[model samples]
Target chain A: MQLDVVVGFFLLGMVAQLLKAPIKMPKGLYESLTLFLLIAIGLKGGVALNSHASGDLLIQAAAIIGFGLVLPLIAFPILYKMGGLSRIDSASVAAHYGSVSVATFAVAMTVVEANGIEYEPYFPLFVALLEVPAIAVGLWLARDRNQELDLKKAAHEIFLNQGVLLLVGGLLIGWWAGARTDSLMPFFSSLFHGVLALFLLEMGRIASSQLGVLRNFGSFIASFGVLMPLVGAGLGALLAHALELSTGGVILLATLGSSASYIAVPAAMVVALPKANQSLSITASLAITFPFNVLVGIPLYSVLVGHWS
Target chain B: MKKRAFAFEMAVSFVLMALGLVLVQLGLPGYGLVVVAAILMGLSFVTRKWVAQTANVKVAAPKRGNH
Candidate 1:
């Protein structure tokens, strides 16, 4: 799996920062790109599901949800005990890991398309399904059972968060509109990669910014950042194989497993786990895990597909 | 210098690499990675001796001059 050329933009952004070159991705443009990618991915999945929806999908959906739930469970112990993070911080980091990164997924999708590897089109549906479970699980782990969780607020964060709302909303619109949504292909699907490159450029700048702050838990957290994703991808490959997904499906699943959230989880955790040190998890997810997954884990997971089968 | 502490960290990382291979054989690649992580935690514990040693090392105080 050759590295995608779009990743070059990310390296460019990081290099520019290192050189102290004047460059800025406007706040508005960054937000718009994020929204564009989210809606595009969701719409594509919804369109695909219009034809392919079936009983087996229900099983796969349950399994995907289970996958989301399990990732954070596995990560919390390593973080709290091994990484020596506080309970709140550990739960926060675990939640971020367990959730998926849209940008990484977009990059993997680009590579898959460039290679002409056929994958299940309804994959975006699985993406929507995956966004929530880890967050709920993480919150459960962090909060005391005796203390009442504000159900309304939690529901809003999990279901109505920007990532979920756009993905699921786009999915439903595509599913309902079906053939009518074809007109949308020009904007949502065609311009997808271009927007993603811009998004990643901004991500590179942000990830580079996280570098100076990493000294606090640099080694242990960094180690976990790289290692845990591999673990997630390894497990995801096994699950995908058991479900008998295609080679492309397997790769996507593995990529999904390895990618961690910098967007949805942080937005939700800020409201949910206010006392938790958000920077620790954000630095680990964005600065460490996100870059590693985009650069290395995606390709490595692709290679492991042959062995795991 | 407690070379033992540094050696232990190095040894743990190498053992994890080998352990990951073994677990892959068992088709538990994910669990293998997790197990490696759990054990990797131990390296942090063993390195505390080195941390203590470094903390105790006396640093020469800077000579005060014109501000």
Candidate 2:
């Protein structure tokens, strides 16, 4: 298959990650870069949807949401049993498989945008919604049957965690406050590309930093990371087509459904499912599968969307 | 299954997603989405770091006892 630019960026990011010490992006800048990417993608999607929003689109959103919830339910057990993780670890990992990664989805959106492909604007919103259920399910899985559940801790982790709140929160505020173009536009619009570029740069740094971990358990993690997303994409596409979504809706659904929640899921997992091996979850999401999805996954999904839709 | 907490998070996530959808419905343009997402994601990262630190400190406190 011919490699696309987004995939190239994904590779570049991975290369930067592998060479982290020499390519020094400050850790502090990482999140900021990711933020920029999401906002940029969101704005573009928002602009596109101005003419297109309808009842069918909402149905498609529901499909994406269903895909997000279902794919993890199917994939996590395989990952857990095959990867030799403890039950809690498996559940945490499984939870991540269930949630969508806003950053990766953002990157995919950037790719689709650069390619001039039309996709649903609500996809990111679906991505945000997708983050929660897997977490709830994962927590349920990880919770000790013998011990009384601590409602307070669960509440804090779910409600207060920055990732869950911010991406979803920002997207909602921007959507509801529609056409606040005079003042809010400049801040949201001008600064996003620079932020994403920087975020990718920092991602390079993070992937590289995680290299040591990869070499030790590279095979198992990489296999799962690559396979899981494909599993998600497959399920997403089937669901979209079954729902008779538009081509763009189908593509967006596939991407959202396939994408893993590296940021939101991992952060929440650290609190919600403490016994789970975070390093494994983080490495799988960020180091192994994330780059792979961006590079090969998006184009592959495009083709799948193209062929299936 | 803390009813209140679960409901709050689900509610918050639902609102965020809906907000994003509405933004796209309007003609505010692409950069607006990016900036908004960037700020939210950045804040999330900060909060994640804070939580991680607390989790680590809690983990380490008992280790100190062994020493």
Best by TM-score: 1
What are the per-residue Cα lDDT tens digits for candidate 2 across B1-67? 2233223333333443454456456532223223333433443344446656878999999989997
Give one clash count per candidate, in the order shown.
0, 24
Name the candidate that leads on DockQ.
Answer: 1
TM-score (2 decimals) of chain A in model 1 = 0.97
Model 2 lDDT tens row, A32-147: 66655556555544544554568776776666566656766776676555555577877888888888777777666666666677765656566666778778887777778876
| Least well predicted 10-residue stretch by lDDT in candidate 1 chain A | A300-309
Runs in model 1 lying further than 4 Å from the true structure: A145-148, A306-309, B1-67
DockQ of each: 0.11, 0.02
Best by lDDT: 1
What does candidate 1's lDDT look like per residue over A1-309, in tens digits?
567888888887777877778677665998999999999999998889999999999999999999999999999997887656788899999999999998888888888788787889999998888899999999998997766778789789888999999999999998998889988899888888888888888888888878666655535666677767878888888898888888878999898998899889999998888888999988988987888777766765665664555
